[model samples]
Target chain A: MSQHYRTLTANSSSYFVLVLALTALALFGLAAAHYMESEGHWITGMNNQIVWGLPHVFAISLILSASGALNVASMASLFGKTEYSAWSRFSGLLAISLLMGGLLVLVLDLGRPDRLIVAITHYNFKSIFAWNIFLYTGFIVLVAIYLWFLFERKMNQYVKVAGLFAFGWRFILTAGTGSIFGFIVARQFYHSAMMIPLFIVLSLSLGTSVFILVTQIVGRLSGSFMKQEISFSLLRLLGLLLALEGFLICAFYLTGLYSAARYDVVLFVLINGGIYTFLFWAGQIVIGTVVPLGLIFLAKAQLNSSIRLVSATVSKMIGSFCLLYVMVIAGQSYPQLMFPGKQIRSTFFDGVVVHYAPSWPELALGMGGVAVVGIIILVVTRVLPFLPVEEQRAQSSQ
Target chain B: MSGSSENLGSVDLKRRKFMVTMVASMAGAGFNLVELAMAKTSLEAESKLVRWGLLIDTEKCGVGCNACVSACNTEHNLEDHGRPETDAQWIRKLDLVDEQTSHVHSLPMLCQHCEHPPCVDVCPTGASFRRDDGIVLVDKHTCIGCRYCMIACPYKARSFIHENLTNQRSWSPRGKGVVESCTFCTHRVDTGRIPACVEACHAEGGGAMTFGDMVNPESEISHRLKSEPSRQIREDLKLNTGVRYQNV
Candidate 1:
């Protein structure tokens, strides 16, 4: 609870080069967004049929994980876990940067990105998309306030209230993100109320996975380590959350498949849907759910070992990305049913499984978001104290 | 007492005016509301009083005939630039084959212009909106091109302009980086003329499409729907589409 934090000197050539590289990547993303905005979305692989592509996948995953990142702060302040309070500031910082990264991608992907102000000014209470604009903005502000409370010793008492607000806000934010797809009645795959909970579980697992990775990086860079016991506890919690997420996904898939109306979609997702099937089973089921579960469920003797922690963390990270990719991309590629009793043939690719191969620009922009987040973290950690409490070192010391 | 009495007099006058309006409306209730409106103003403005709709007799739609699609393309200045995947299809014949019986039914699919449009419901900027006369449209000025409406549309009727567009019709203003769909030939419909597709169908394809006001029971589409038993595509969604199909 009495942890004293300090900023990194970040004087090493390698560290400077890493920051420079990430900044370049972020700038490249901005350039790509500008090019697409000026030229058209046709430059990207997104067409009239598969309107959303890699941009959406990356954006949603980042945003959901951003909300999850705040779990550390929430547990610390909101749930009265004083030990985690040491890391709450770091959580708040990561959460803000992640949200900014995700939001930049989403805004740039808009067909009329120039008229972004219109989106904010207009109110469509019925639309989940409209609600999300507020949710996302509210989260950033809440994170800022939570971090402020952490930094300002006098206002530490209000940290709990801010964390509570942030906790509730993020719940709605992630739920709204899921509902964007779920409330879509036109599609065979989405429209279940259960998607809300499914996404929440997804956010928790992915969030924790990202947190574990950040913690490791923080420990390495700052030379102040998270206690072995705390790391173990966090990993175990991640494993439990992943298991819950796995159950929810399975239950959701089965429930959706059971409906006669959705039988075709189920077949497409599980059987005939080529890339979609691969993504669902191989990418999501095996890599994401299974590997993490396997790593986390290791025997107590192995679990206590440092090697086990690193392996588990790495697998969990891979798993989160895989599941999110499947959830976003494959979920969209499947054809929507316009006619229940009839097979359709059309030039507009109606009533057919659509394939989405994201072009170079799309992939660049997607990774740009990650680079932006990384750059922010790097710069912030160097300028401000975001690491665990350690002996203060002057800016001259590397 | 005098001030109170004057106030009572104004209140009495308001009540008297309300009674007069109520009595007048009640009297005109015997006549069609559209007819009674002749006293107020000319029907020159396309009033929401009429809900325009289309009744398509799918049985009469000729196989391999793309008269309607061709007409829609020309009418809206929708050019095909060798990219069928990205081009906007204002209307196209959906060649539907019954999976079990192998029975085939072909019907032109376009924007349904539902009474409760999902596109309108999901648009973040409220740009996707339904006109009072039952025509759904996107206000390009306000549309941020987010394409959430496309995600919400049940019929897959919407299209996004993937490439930079040029040579657009003055009547149908379109541009790149914005979502667009069939406006049901609003320019022609506003002028009290049938949609280009309906005219095309009557001329070249087949006498399959009937366009008129669904709100008017005496209108051809209204009468046809009532007599022939037509159905809206995805009727389960309860969108109450302005477009209907018969003998599918």
Candidate 2:
């Protein structure tokens, strides 16, 4: 019992250190945002052609993460998966945190953050962005209430019903996110009907991986064991989902190439030819998906205890990072207009017809948003009995 | 049966008389307003023909003289910044190349004054709107610095004044943070003067741009369209743009 307490203390210290680092980074970002607002969007690297930059990418990633987290929590609570019940509360808390973080980044990205309320009041029913405002707000509220019921209140049949409602709505909310890009017929790369389903699948994979990583890290710190059955099941689920995601990405590129859409094909070439290609193929694919799957397979095949745990932990982290990177690139790479003859050349950056590199200030604000997520997760874990306290005690005594 | 037939006849007669009176009165009112408005302008055309549009010949547009650009800046009081992309340009010449074939083509680009303008549709405050005469304009008074119009515009004709601009007339509404685009030189059109760009193009030998009332059968723009083949940019979009290009 003393050894377990010591382990918890050490883990808490590390989490605290991480939280502190993220907070400092966020403050720097806030300062940059203030300066940007005082001045204008001109302070950033964005130009006429590349109006959106890194902040937009980060915001989209956060939204994806939030949606994904909600999916995992729903699988346990709404689907009546008793094995996943232990991690449901933590997942719910993370979902709300990521959603809030996503919204913050999105608001900061806007040239006129002061006019945010106007976006809500003035709705274009035809525009997907207008719908997203409502969907995202509703999703956050549902998740918050769901988490509250799990952690603060006694879990009841009503809570399960609410969980089911949240789980169902999140799919539409994520679909709405995809439609924001998918509806633009002008952009050939994003005009496909497959984007909505792709977003949902990616959200599931990313959401599950993040939940797993957070659980493992927290368990390791507190010297509490997550049920081995739940951990293995999640790992296996993630492996299969990732494998499908990888296959779909290949099919997407092949169709783009075969279609011979000149401007649209350029997006693929830019990602594959430049620094982004390495990030895509190496960081996103190999480190994030392939190696992680291999490690999980080895662990399941009765590999050494130390190796299995280390690989599982590494795999989760890499998967989360990969999911984030893919979303960012996808949002940024596609130009505003994708018509073949009607191309507007950008003059903002040199050495290309049109180029986009996120400014330092944008990056800082994005990092700050990431920090906010960490802080929220940390606070929630501390206040609520995120772990099954009774189960832990019984196991320790045995 | 006879009584009912007689009643129906009386009702039909009354309706016909009412319709005639209403049509006559509306036409009278419309004519009076037009006369009153035209009386205020000294250079008003005798025929009351106004709201000029341009027919640009993309093939004949020379890359040499930027006379249209210079005239637009002088008339609009636009800053003489070297970077035309950042600075406002009511009219710009673009050199386009076919990505597959490397075939190059040059065309002078500006606002198309689309029949169904996306910018006007998306404006939350009705800052951007089309006038009755079919010219699209932005009222800077109601603009709230939100660049929704910029994103909605397919032609990318709109520009936002990012910094504080001076030398604007005290009565003039356009300023910083508001969107501005080519108005087809509405002020000059109201006074029966050709737009600065059209006049400049004419000075360089009327081969590039021809301006006149599109509705007038005898107008130069109408004559050019009849005599030569012309095409609108992004015709597939079905925006029904006022601006036409020749020899694309």
Candidate 3:
């Protein structure tokens, strides 16, 4: 049976309010970025010690999730899961929207946001960051073309090829993101080959969680429904991804714990680094990983599937943020090991774990990126027939 | 003396007049007399033959001697913003106490100017670069202030400018939102002078610092490095840092 999609009516008062709210938040975020740039980064909590702060955590999470958002579309086209084909168009749109949101944060957070043109024009092949610029833009273009193929009846023949290409590019995109930290040999926390796989899995977990949340919220608001089986299947996929994410995170820290050189940093994050330690165990490992896993696998029989799914996805989202916060911010906060077996002191914050408290503007800028994603999805669904509609159910609802 | 005067008087009048006229014109047009005297002008461009480096004898570096740091600040016009964490420190005094032995070592730490700089490797815009003379410098024009170089530098030698400023030195040319670090006093080095830190260390502190050409075997730095035991800070990375330390 041919699946049908429909444009959102967008006549509801609630939808209008949401669109207005998201737009306001996005604009506020832009204003925050402007203030930070005009006055200087000192207004923010970021110092020389922690160069990248909250903005990085938010930006990286969205970017990784963007790739993962396309997983449903990949499943339909690449893995031949026909049940998932209905969700493909929405998935493609969500992927692009999420990427645009993430890119906005990353670019605006730059010291010279005005030199964005320079970043685009210049190419440093050895730098993973340069490679990511290409990967990010290329993924958007490829996914758009894939979406085009899915939309046009005449172009249906080559959808698989486009899907395959996009699928491959997203892996590289996520790898490039992970390698941003992995390639930093100077830091005790990074410079491991395992960063690539860990990031890829993270993208999968975060992306799937986001897709599930969006799928349900949009479905309910648009007065459409999916087969409970399909919803259950998506939850199962997220559960598997979370398990993989947990395993990789453990392996990453365990390997570092084995090395005496990496022991201090590991101990700091896992045990006694205060806020960082708490975020890792309570926010990242327990809430982000284990709780979600338990809720999905164990609580499924007793709880409503929708409630279980939402709780798990929301928990995972919180956990993902914690994980990134600990990884990016805490990773830099730890002092560089200049002298291996000596206590070194300097005015430049050497030999001490630097303190960073995210300023208001930084928080505003990060939240704004999330808002941008929401506004994009809201506007796009209204203008275009991106929403999946079950034909029989649509007729019954009308 | 009379015979020498008679020989000088016998010299061609026109040649002497032409030489005087040329020197006066060049001087009027803002020529550096020092550059002329050195014979190898700055316009000749830096050469690979001259690898500028420093050798610091940590044993001679006295505790609480802020002369080197003070000189570096004065030279670079590094103003104190009262926020040490965010302030631009071109050079700072470092105190290292052995965990096992309790022996304290005091030294001044700054950019090492590595032969293969990680900052240059990781710079997305090619802003961070190493000159032919082995003086690593950041071309601020291309620096997006990404701080990747700051992350890549093992010594934590780089500083990101965090606030707006006025009265920046014409020679230094620093601004907010860009990364800066020890340039090995490139402005002074280009004009045939030692770095401010080294000069101050020699004159006011413990005479711990030596600045010279590492490539020149006849130079004091090369002689000292070959004759005595000197080591790079992180030898395992094999960055081949131009700066070396002795008796740490």
Per DockQ, the best of the predicted structures is 3
Ranked candidates (DockQ, high to low)? 3, 1, 2
Best first by TM-score, ranked:
3, 1, 2
Measured on C-alpha atoms, candidate 2 has an lDDT of 0.67
TM-score of each: 0.90, 0.78, 0.94
lDDT of each: 0.83, 0.67, 0.89
Best by TM-score: 3
Candidate 1, residues A1-398, lDDT tens digits: the string is 37788776656777778788888898888899989988888778888878888888899889988999888888998777876777888899989988999998999888888888888788888888999999999999989998998899899888889999999999999899989988889877777777899888888778887887877666666665666667778888988998888889878888878887777787777888787778778777887778767877755685545666677767766666666666666666777787777889888887787777888888889889999998899889888987865422321243
Sequence-dependent TM-score of model 2? 0.78
Better of 2 and 3 by DockQ: 3
> Please, what are the lDDT tens digits per residue for candidate 3 over residues B108-168?
8999999999998888888888998999998888888888898889988899998898788
Cα displacement (angstroms), candidate 1, residue A283, comes to 1.6
C-alpha RMSD for every candidate: 12.4, 13.8, 6.5
lDDT for A252 in candidate 3 is 94
lDDT (10s digit) by residue, model 3, range A56-144: 88999999999999999999999999988988998999999999999999999988889888788876778888888999999999999
Relative to the true structure, candidate 3 has a C-alpha RMSD (angstroms) of 6.5
Task: Give chain B TM-scores in order.
Answer: 0.81, 0.75, 0.85
Please write out the lDDT profile of model 2 over residues B110-169, one tens digit for every residue.
Answer: 788887777776665566787655678887665654565665666667776644566764
Write down the worst ten-residue block by lDDT for model 1 chain A: A389-398
